[model samples]
Each structure stands twice: as C-alpha cells, then as structure tokens.
Target: MAIGGVTIFATLGYFALYSNKKPEASAKDVAKVTAGVAKPGNTRPR
Candidate 1:
C-alpha cells in the first residue's frame, strides 16, 4: 500500500512539474487556426 501511494504521488508530481515547464503554442499557430473560420466554405464540423 505504501508503494502504491508513493507511485501515485510520484506520477502526480511529474505531471505537475511537466505542465509548469511545458511550452505554449505559438501565436502564429493560434492565428492560423483562428483564420480558418474566415474561409468561405462551410465552417460547421460534421
């Protein structure tokens, strides 16, 4: 039971650190996606 608790905490700590250190998506990429809405064709997804 102690081993399982440690494993769970370790996984949670790893994700916490990973998320804090993760890179954000670039503005260009964000703009590209936003610009897709302006296209003349049907915008609604099937």
Candidate 2:
C-alpha cells in the first residue's frame, strides 16, 4: 500500500512539472503556420 501511494504521487508530480510544457521547435512551427494562414493586415506585430 505504501509503495502504491508513492508511485501515484510520483506520477502526478511528473505530469505537474512537464504536462503543459511544449517543445520550443513545435511552438515556432505553429507560429509559422498561423502566420501563413493569417491575412496580411490582420497579422500580429513582431
């Protein structure tokens, strides 16, 4: 029972630290795609 509890907490902690973090390359790729589809006048300023 103690081992199971520890395992569960470890899993939760791992996800808490890493779940919302994305790769830098992936973020840049998404930005490029979004900019590609955006209208010329509606784009964000750099």
Candidate 3:
C-alpha cells in the first residue's frame, strides 16, 4: 500500500511539473489545424 501511494504521488508530481508546458499556438499554426479539420468530408453537422 505504501509503494502504491508513492507511485501515485510520483505520477501526479511528474504531470504537475511537465503538463501544460507547451508553447502557445501561433495564429498560423491554429489556421493550419483549422484548415485540416475543415477539409472535405471532415465536417459533421451539429
């Protein structure tokens, strides 16, 4: 049980330190992604 607790804590700490560290997307990158998703047959009616 103690080992399990340590493992959980370590996992949480790793993510806490590393997660959400990505650089913010630039407008060009956003537009490229949007364009890919908007290509033919990719759209679904909402």
Best by TM-score: 1
lDDT order of candidates, best first? 2, 1, 3
Local accuracy of candidate 2 as per-residue lDDT tens digits, 1-46: 9999988876665455344434432443344443455343333334
Residue 38, candidate 2: alpha-carbon lDDT = 37
The local distance difference test score of model 1 is: 0.47
- In candidate 2, residue 21 scores what lDDT? 38
Error of 1 at 43 (Å): 44
What are the per-model C-alpha RMSD values against the true structure?
A: 13.3, 12.7, 12.3
Stretches of candidate 3 off by over 4 Å are 20-46
List per-prediction Cα lDDT, in the order shown.
0.47, 0.49, 0.47
Question: Candidate 3 vs. truth: CA RMSD?
Answer: 12.3
lDDT of 1 by residue, 1-46 (tens): 9999988876665555445441553333333344443332332232
Clashing pairs in 2: none
Model 1 alpha-carbon miss at residue 34, Å: 36
Which is the winner by TM-score between candidate 1 and candidate 3?
1
TM-score of 3: 0.42
* Local error of candidate 2 at residue 40 (angstroms): 42
lDDT of 3: 0.47
State the lDDT at 41 in candidate 1.
Answer: 31
